[model samples]
Target: MTDSCIQKQLTEPGQEGPVTVSISRQVMPGCETAYEAWISGVIEAASSYPGHQGSNVLRPSASTQNRYVLIYRFDSYENCQNWESSALRGQWLDKLDGLVQGDAEVQRGTGLEFWFELPELPVNKHPSPHKMALVLISVVYVLVISLNLLLAPILVDSGLWLKSAVIVILQVLLMTYLVMPRVTRLLRSWLFK
Candidate 1:
């Protein structure tokens, strides 16, 4: 009900072959560490069960209600369900029964089942400066390298390695200032909440 019309329009509710599931949870007032320990244990144990892609824990953002997001990316839809229904899963869920407040909401995936034609994209279409900046930098690098070869001798003679050094410096600064912080912020947002 809180979702926007555009959000609804863009999504189709159904299972594709393989999908990641997100289980969001709120830590009981003082149970943050305990909640994490339990979930981490489950993640380690899931390896023996097979079909588990991996788990990403998201801490709650200031705007969000839930405090934690447990994202379990499964290799397949069936595999995800199997993990949910498995005996080990039951044990894990049982351990958290009263430790966390409210039931968890599991989002099947980021959308797009992924096939030969449509491989998985590293980042979703969210407003990610990290991804976009990287793409732009890559294109610029290709153009610069191609152009550099033509002007190579003169530039080299002029001690132009400094230009390349400047670019590398800029890259590191941008990554540190603009990209990595936001990424880790969101990553920890998923973890600590």
Candidate 2:
């Protein structure tokens, strides 16, 4: 299964900032199969929704029975709200009525907080500062060197400030929407360890 978010340009005119919604739930004993099926159906239904980027599921281990974390991504808050208010999602939740132990806790956020989140963990648990700095430096180094090499000639006639601004904006966008998520996911074992 693909574990990465779909690579799409998440920023466009009139679009709200990208959003991440997390749903944490506890399944009743012997309801894992039913819960899994319900989750699949919801994901399938969500895929047809506007601005749906992707999703990630973190199933509980033997040591963490009955717990599951579902992370969904949308290009904007409005789009995510649309999904949340949709009848299809309502139907899915209805199916879970007796199968789940209690009300699922939901959390939502935008910006770097979404990308930096660790699967199955609380938001307050972040990577160490040293690991974060290393990742940031690595990503920025590669982006700056590659982008500068490619854009320098094109922006040669432009003012230095203009060139710098363009590069900075591009870097921020790529880091926020693209590079950081992939890198963090790839290095999760090391970073989290």
Candidate 3:
């Protein structure tokens, strides 16, 4: 396959930029903590590498076979590759010889280390997903409230505090009960092995 910087790559008929996610499992016994620490290092170290966008680490509520998901969102396939083969991670991978399985993504895909292919996402400037999700939810709620106010001025409540409180409560309930589960599910796929 051809490797090219995603930003410079022209959009092709059937090709799309990828948001690659890796789901790897530890092979040797008693190295779960080491594996996680090493993967976490890889995620943090990725920021220094080219095309590095952002990363998320997922661990199951209970450990079974020692699995972890490392979701690295990159600017392009080329950037992901640059991060993968860099000296920044060489030692980390080498350290995995007796800890993690030799095959990077054995059960995650046919053979590739990556699990899922997402349409290219613009690099997020936010350091936290909660912040990003909150901002988006807030903006959408504001738009809906504004439309309601325009339609019926009488519904505008007496106290802004009360209205704001109501919104906050509703958002919290929705987020806790509805949103977090889906995020957990998406991250869990990385441990299919």
Q: What total of clashing residue pairs does each candidate reach?
A: 13, 0, 0
Candidate 2 residues 1-193, lDDT tens each? 2434333435554465788888888988888999898898899999999999898788986523447888898988888989999998988888998788877777787655565675456545667667777888888999999999999889989998999999999998898668887887788888777
* Error of model 1, residue 98, in angstroms: 2.8
Point out the higher-scoring one by TM-score: 1 or 3. Answer: 1
Off by over 4 Å in 2: 1-15, 62-66, 119-137, 143-193
lDDT of 1 by residue, 1-193 (tens): 6578556456333444447665667789888888889988988977666667566666776534546877666766667777888998888888987788776655554333211010112222232445445544664575556556755665565665776765566555555346444544445433222
Best prediction by TM-score: 2
TM-score versus the correct structure, for each prediction: 0.51, 0.60, 0.47
* Model 1 lDDT, residue 26, Cα: 77
Clashes of 2: 0
State each model's CA lDDT, in order: 0.59, 0.81, 0.52
Lowest lDDT 10-residue stretch of candidate 2: 1-10
TM-score of 2: 0.60
